[model samples]
Target: MFFDRKELTNDQLVTFYRQILLPRMIEEKMLVLLRQGKISKWFSGIGQEAIAVGAALAMQEDEWLLPLHRNLGVFTSRKMPLHKLFLQWQGHPEGYSKGRERSFHFGSKAHHICGMISHLGPQLAIADGIALAHLLAGEEKASLVFTGEGGTSEGDFHEALNVAAVWNLPVIFVIENNGYGLSTPVEEQYRCSQLVDRAKGYGMEGVRIDGNNLLTVYDTIRGVREYCVREKKPYLIECMTFRMRGHEEASGTKYVPAQLFETWGRKDPVVLFENWLMSQAILDADGVERERQRIRATIEEELQLAGAAGPADFTFQDEIADVYAPASEITGEIPGSDRELRFIDAIKEALDEALQTHENLILMGQDIGAYGGAFKITDGLADKYGVARVRNTPLCESAILGAALGLSLEGYKAMVEMQFADFVSVGFNQIVNNLAKLHYRWGQSADVVVRLPTGAGVGAGPFHSQSNEAWFTHVPGLKVVYPSSPQDAKGLLLAAFADPNPVLFFEHKALYRSITGIVPDTAYQIPIGKARQVHQGNDISIITYGAGVHWALEFATAHMEIGLDIVDLRTLQPLDYDAIRQSVMRTGKVIVLHEDTLTGGFGGEIAAWIGEHCFEYLDAPVTRCAALDTPVPFNTTLETQFLPKARLREAIQRLVSY
Candidate 1:
């Protein structure tokens, strides 16, 4: 697809071709660097450089841009130093701190880039939030987010777009259709003929363009950017591009159809753009040769400088750098308010309080406005905070999360919500790759909070019932908190918003209304990464979180004959390993429990850690009680059978007998 020629000039077209070729060479050099053991992994936007550079150039400094992993060219064209990028791949902290070397998967704040998260779809939704924040703050900034065609299939994509369109968010969504998600081709990804066509379902504008043609990509992005800013509507632009290399440095996808690869290579966007530039008389033979020579020298100098830079200070003291919020200085007394509200209501209070306390705080989610959010966590927020601060986003989770990362760099504290925690899988790429590692990779902070209504008891079934704490606990730089009571929920939620690093805050659906406690009236802050001892017993310790905490306590009370101490792990990340060891030391026995499947649940990590650290104190093997490895059955009886319960009367009895 081509844009009408009246839009772009010959000079602009020539520059686009030159920029595309520059990054292509960089990609090839990085590939060689990886093969020679100089770098760990190389992600080159060799074939798709036009789209990245075009969209990036279209964005103004104040406006936001969230690019995907393969968009390093975007950062470079925007003035990111190549040496810094190389240093990042070489595991040098200074490399990322100085330049935009951190865009491999996670983004860098130094360059006004958003936190690069591995989760795919959430960035779209976050873009909605950024647009809303600018509008609400009465600022003249627009927001743009980039993703792949494969990410468009995620439910979060639909959710983000639906919300953004309904609310008329000033956001642009760019789909870089490189044709493959890892090894799965776009044909195998979705039945839809075009990724942009799905925008009709959300009542938004959608267009497909030649991603490799910088003129087309730039014109399309500039139009959408202006529309989002002026009309306050979202746009979906699909840039049909290609990837000329393997999925990752480690991947050798032998399954891709040979014919398809050859066809894509022949229509390479970089070559096509160059050919177009020559046809347009923007460059002669000598000019093209000179431009190529300059790019080569730049690359060589960048590599030399990067190689000269030594390794990072891997000392243990450096580990504490980004662990906690720097401004977490305890203010005297945070008086509690006397509002006896529902769990979701407390969430609203916390969000408002955060926005009031921190100027950077921006909120975005699905149906979160006059619609009051999917669960009303943001009821009346759009009206009160204005459409900018209280943004209702499109259904694209990856984009939402990615945009939040970008918005965060502009010094905005962002809180993006997923309709359900189960749907977080859609944005898993943003979470694992970007949010969790951005601070570490880029040597910058990402103060972002993502709240999801999680857990199974509500009968939401397999799609909505997933308790995904285990999926995130393994990721570094992310703190996972699941509160069982409204009081704990409010306190932990506030704490998460106050954190410097990204956090996953899950409010169990079953506890939102069914449970209530004496929560403080106002913003009562709680420290993260600290476990609360709910009960004391000399016999054994039951370690759990979320819904399981309540059940474990109930089981302990019901079987009072067996003295069981319950440890509520309010924060799953940066786990209180010392507290666990101390509890084990006192009781000489421990049992790990969770609601997720037994195979790869958080319990496995806990059990292994305990086995390694407190093996001598254990009176028995570290036992874990969890749900069976099966999708949450729709039948109540089957769910009950499959779910984890504290009928620990038997386990307790067995432990005592042993």
Candidate 2:
């Protein structure tokens, strides 16, 4: 409780007293409000105010902070508006997430605070991303992240720390060992004697400090921050603190031993700081009460403004509008087509152009540097653009994805390639939870393009080959681009990179080198949602995208007398419904073809859309030609039968006759 650490001036000592008291006082009032049924919930950082407050005073204003839900001291110390902070708790429109998110789960770009989400661990890697951005921009800024002892057990913790150490990124990994992780004690969390001990495994120094001591937290963090920036390396620190209240008011701390509150009460951050302040002659007993009253009055005034905002205004249209950004307005000049290139070459061409054109462009993935990539799609890119721009990452997809999100926050265009589409499952949380919901929750553009080497044909089997585009189309706030040809692949990729949203650009491995088409010599943006009519006919229409387009084209050419029409729906999320309606209306019969298996495949979506919108125009029920509902097999014979290629002809003939 008492610190004999770094010496401070009179005003500095007084400042620490006020900073530590602020969150403690505010949290107490909110708990009262919760008991009175005025507020829904509260995550109390009551006993551990010093760590958050001290870190706030320690880090530079420009330095990025990724704090957990309970660290209200960081917000108040950063001078975040108390009115809006209260509004966030009240779920008012003026809150950080505009009332879209509950609790202190929102961050302020203005304040440079990146709040931790409910999932908790991914933000550690996200902090790495912010630090990585600073490193790339040649800024000496460091990123500080807070995690509880339990959070250290997550795989992201290991990935983030290793990545930071390897890249020499400026990041301060602060573990607030709050003893219990939602009632699971620290002893149960890890077998290690202390969380700081893991730092050596990542080739970094780790320090332990008294989290309850206000002066110690500030002094330790300030010193470590200097070291991080000077050396451009990561440092780990463990703040020994205790959670005074339950994780949330709703979940009572009955599971916590009663003696902990008594024992830790002696080491209370506020009580210790207040006694230390009185010893410094900053305040007496009466002065302490007056200071508390003064802070309470300030909170009350801010609460009035926050309460005036009323409940959040909810509208169905606003919900839909916030899901994804609208189509890009100005799509730059469309250059003429000049050369025929393979699908892989076209994608590489787009990446090459992006690196040349975008100064802040960065390419990150596993084996993407000198060795190129698993398929060599990024071959020679590292040679052309330096290794820094075309970077290889550890086999940690979640961390890399989070880093890309962080870079995007720093106004950089990041392109991340997943070795295989199925491998994306490893980083699925970063995509579906963070990347997909970042803008919709906090109004920040995640301008990242995730290149997916997808589809099944070359017997790469389950892990390597899978048509996983449908997996992302189901999630909002992400644009799903699955181009059919080398030409479309190049234009769509360039367009995906230019668009201000999270995009999953699915590159079918089966077509990457096998297919070649005329591509533009100069980079051009093809509007994402637009579809192109591949073949014109009258009787039956085949609508598809990705590998299915090639099969449909072959069939269209082979059975020219059957009068078949083919349409390639380029982007899945912002589907070209107009094109779909027109095609179904003209042909009267439709066959939705796709490489993904039946049942949950995207073909069902298109067929359902046709049934819903073009019911009257249809001469027969909409048919579907898709792979069997099973994982792609290794055997070529079975793989051929599993795909829609074998079924396309039968489906088209049946639809034409019907």
Candidate 3:
């Protein structure tokens, strides 16, 4: 629970009143515009202005804010220009997202605010990362994140609170209990007596407060901040308030009983604050009207300027633009030592070198610290860099990934290792929706490298053995790197760290110690979206990656008379189409092979592209070899048959014979 609030000065009281009044007036005017068909939509924080206004004013400007749909006061209280916010609201070019997104879905780094995704729970975990940055830098700053009462039910909410409590992050988790999550009542949302009580479960302090009282809000939050910065811990504040309007202006509030409004209406935050100011003789009725007029006139001027900026003109090409950072001019191979290292050791060497090279690098995952992770990839590195750099995380994959994105926002690069590639399913929302879309939607770089120990040779069963790269390759704004051999593994992992987007680095679980190759002693980079020719004969080409690369090379080596050309597609995304085309054109026949299942595999994509582009040159139909459409089996014999190992020879014979 928060400490007792000290009395506020007259100036502080007046400032709070004015800040609370500003959002109320702006929302009121926006309602008129909404009716008149100017603004498209609005999430009215009409009666609950004090929660946003008071919270924003109480926190330092240096602290970051993760705000949701209805918190209009956060933008205004931060002194973000009304005109630009209006442009953002109107989907114009001058806005933060440059009309790439609408509503409050854009963050302003200058104002120290990260916008919320529609999936509200993920932001809770992201706030942990922002607070982690403060902890890393030894700064007093904390991160404040808000979620509705309904959001507390999300898995990310639990993950976030648990992580924050475990790590002792300075995050002020504010839950705005506005009586409804859309149409569902609060009673249906939870069985707990109060949302703030959840803090006890996470081993943190919490307090419920009168959100309608502007003075209480300002003082309580100020005290909460002081306690957070001093104690270096998490605290929850449930602001007890009611929505004065529908969830959005488009959604009517008929579900809300009329009597309920009458009760909550009397406790209106703006009127409560205004009456307090008048009774104290700090302001009068005339002054109130004069202040409203002053704000109203300012709103009009800002609106005119915003409207004058006109709409954002975007073409189809513009939609594709800014989807990724400038493609790395860094291309070609990494020269290596004669010393042979296992695939896993090569990756470990790259990470160890990276920790020494960059100070802002952070490694987070389950058992990744002193325990050295599930596969020992992080072995002894935590001992060298300390657990601060090579950090261990909870079972909450979604929260950890969100935190990685947040850490990136704070000038830090984070590499999160999913113990198994299959576990990425638990955190897909953060990977695809949050990290993959952050830069294109808001121009914020999400420099995260997630090392996914992937593929299906370990007989780890259905849950553990998975080739999930195809799922991510379909998602734009992500770089998917899947390398084969010790050399490419070391080189590409370094390249993944350099690229300014979220990258999925897939490492085969079986290849860790089974295969060894020449690897560079120090750090190096291989160009992503490039391929290498493993075998030179041009009679027929086998396009492959990951475990498939080894499979194809062995088959080509054994069948010397077949005249096979094996092209290793080290990077799955931004596919080395030029290399693919070159192979297809030279051989006049091609086979796409992968460790994943046959249907909807990356093999299907390569085959489709070859058919579409190189049909004229292809002497035969482009063939594909992949595992059967079933879960990876537990038995080694069943798994071997389930994989493409047996199917590749048949695929090669067909393509070569044709």
lDDT (CA) for every model shown?
A: 0.77, 0.88, 0.89
The residue-by-residue lDDT of candidate 1 on 317-336, one tens digit each, is: 56666543464843435455
* lDDT over C-alpha atoms for residue 581 of model 1: 87
Q: Taking the tens digit of each residue's C-alpha lDDT, what string does model 3 give over 314-414? A: 77876787788665678555664798999999999989888887789999999998889999999999899999999999899999999998899899999
- In candidate 3, stretches whose alpha carbon ends up further than 4 angstroms from where it belongs are 1-7, 331-333
Quality of model 3 by C-alpha lDDT:
0.89
Model 2: residue 324 alpha-carbon error in angstroms: 2.8
Q: Candidate 2's residue-wise lDDT over 460-521, tens digit each?
A: 77778788888888899999999989888888898888888999999889898899998879
Count of steric clashes across candidates, in order: 59, 0, 0
TM-score of each: 0.76, 0.98, 0.97
Worst 10 residues of 1 by lDDT: 97-106
Candidate order by decreasing lDDT? 3, 2, 1
Tell me the RMSD of model 1 versus the true structure: 5.3
Q: How much does each candidate deviate from the true structure in C-alpha RMSD?
A: 5.3, 1.4, 1.9
Model 3 TM-score on a 0 to 1 scale: 0.97
